[model samples]
Target: MTLTKSLLLGTSGALLAVAGAQAADLPSRKAAPVEYVRVCDAYGAGFYWIPGTDTCLKIGGRVRIDTWYTPAKSAVQLRSTGGPAYTGVPGGGTASSTYTSANGIDQLGWYARGLLMMDARTQSGWGTVQTVVTLRLAAQTGLAQAGQLSSVPLAVAGTTGATIEAAYIRFAGFTAGQAASNFTFLPSNQYHSIWSPSFPSGIRQFAYTATFGGGISATVALENMGDLAAATTANSLGFNPYSATAATATAVAPQRLPALVGNVRIDQPWGAAMVSAVVLQNNANFATPGIQAVTNGLGPLVRKTGWAVSAGLRINLPMLATGDSIQAWVSYGVGALNYTAIPNLNANTATTANYTGGFLRGDRDMTIYCVGVGCASYGVEQAAALNIAGVFTHYWTPSLRSNLVGSYIRLTPGSTTRNTDWTNGGLSSATGWSVQTNLIWSPVRNFDIGIELSYARLQQSLTGLNGAAPTAVPCTAAAPMCNASISPSNWTGRMRVERTF
Candidate 1:
């Protein structure tokens, strides 16, 4: 009986132990902590992570607010400037009606600006693939206005889709989509001067790029064609040509094709160098409303084509650290320019000369160059723009840096002239230059504050103004209207603050 009882006790104990083990092995469900990546800078950092793959993701953005001060009378005069006669109302003028000034302080303003960028990449069995998207966001009231008591919204800032500044996909050694053009681009370099004044804007294009290792690459792009001068609303080469006609007819722009551009870049241990060319197609004789014409004509005449070629070099003085370097670039164009202002004037005569070096004579067609492409206005004419820019930068530390920049543009008018029933007009050769110096200090991580001082001089003459100044001849006995060929020059200064997340 004792033996049987012991056996039963042992069996019961063993069963109990097995039951405990089973209970402990039961699965328990719980949520895992979420993982994210973050960036911190004045330009704002991005957040990104792959959900199911090994690919890494990065996201970033920026917000900016700015204030400016200028002399009351220093603004550009709308009604008159020696370049083009104000046939309509006028454009930007003196700071009197446009800005607020108090206690010698010209004006104060703010802008809620932001940029968002996402980069995704993965290592695949075949090769590495990457995709990128960048955009800018801002409140309509972010931009300041001279006429309004407060600020007003800018229609163009966010009216488009998703603040798309750049979008592209890359595989192996090739990239395709919308991004910065290879032409006229400076690589692997950053300085205060690079961002001040007019920074190089991105463009939309279908491009192919080949990397040769060691910072050397070859690139080609087919991009949308337009003039830089059309930065203002409704002033682009794509505007309706009929709208420009004093008499209405049809609405047609100069070209319907894209531009072709290619570039080659080489980076050596000592410095970097790059060269590029672009070609554009132009229909010189198409007429459209609200469009400025290079010349006046009733029907479709000769086709126009334009082109641009540029090169640049940047060398690192071995003594100076990576932050300290010097760079320079030169660009020349011979056709439809991205930034030519169609002078507002009456082309009603056979030959119109501003009497400055500028002239718009009709038998010879006017040609504007764009990205190496050409757009012409029916006759044999040419316009050229030569630009030179240089900058030197010194980084006191990773968070602080200062730079000096100088740029010049020389525009030479060829045989371009416009004729109409009443008047004729054209542009004379002119030169403009700009110089800027700035100091950028980032007191905190992901935040930057800076002060900038810049000066610019733009000079233009009526076509006939190239010769000696016209004698002050009297137009009437009582009212002697002396034709003025000299346009006044302008200067500007700006201060800015930027934050990023």
Candidate 2:
């Protein structure tokens, strides 16, 4: 009996030891604590705190599709023997009696774009610190691709590319980096529309805004003036002459100082108003390896400065109709023609034919000339211009709205021998106008589709040398030959679809 009891006890002890060993070898089940994202309401909607950090961030983006049609893109000229025959000027141009092969024209085009944006903000002892970044990717076809100023043949019928639209930081009432200029006041339309007059789009700058304790405020900024240099240079006949006898012109010197800009604004429930101004410096230097060494002595060209002033008003008319408003602005510039939206002769025209008869044939802002056989000396002359624009928006329904937009520009070159040369070279002072009506429908939140119909006209003075001769056909039944002045009109249609989040 003693031997049996001991054996039983030993067997139980062995079983217990085996179970304890198995338990020690088995895996354990335990989870680490999770750090979940938290909503940040201190800012605005769509903001949340980054896990394990105090910084708050918001991510948003947009996708857009566009289609456009313009007569300027489609009109072509037909030529016959004995001068030129009057071909239909669908876009606008003198009917040249000179015949050549048929030229290709662009009548319709499409564009697709995607945009991404990031906004980050944090509260600090000084003030709210904020940063915004936006990137855009785009693809275009048809006329949109044909008009690009590219040196190399486009890899495809259209182009695909990316661009940094805006990247800026705001802290303590100071803004630094690339962003919209304060000179732009009450802009109410997307940049894709031609009815909107030219406004300083974007530039790298450092600016400070002071709040006057009411809805009123003031801003002063120092913006890069390099873009204006490009505008001035494009107009020079011999600025960067590729061949001899291109006219003795000078090149715009590199910018040495930043443009100065100032603005004063008032905002209230009834509406908003603003007055803005800018001072720009213009500098030029004699052409290097001078086109006419004997004509133009080697020396720096004349230096001049330009100025622009603008005033705008926006009035809310909710009593007339819900969400109705009117915005109007006028601008005047001297030596700063770009502010008038007519700097580059063909900057806005889409078709080559319309470009040929563009409002101004020579430089828009300034001109240079040389005297003597080879152009002995050079002088500078500045241009003056004015721009007027207005827009009215009316809400037809909760999801539908309509906008009427119009703009007009007048440009006059300085009275100088260079101006006369440009006149003989087929350039003259001109006026241009554009009008558009647009309708937009939004069926759901963050998504909208819109369509716009626009008309544009350009009338150029007859003071310049005769352009391409007109066909033998009489200008009218009462007279023979084409009219002295050239006036071209265009019809454009645009459609857009966009989604944002």
TM-score of 1: 0.66
Q: lDDT per model, in order?
A: 0.47, 0.60
RMSD of each: 10.2, 7.8
My TM-score estimates for the predictions, one after another, are 0.66, 0.77
The sequence of per-residue lDDT tens digits that candidate 1 reaches over residues 1-501 is: 999999999999999999999988998778996665433232223434466557667767777665543332212111211112221112111111121112212232244557887887766775768888877764422123222100111212222223466788888766777666667644312211221112133566778778887888998878765422221111111111212222211223454678788989998888889898878754433332223353353335334567878788988865765568788887877653442212111100000011111112111114321111132232334556677878888777879977777767666656422111102123456566666677889888868888766554557554322243422333332222222224433233455678776
Choose the strongest candidate by lDDT.
2
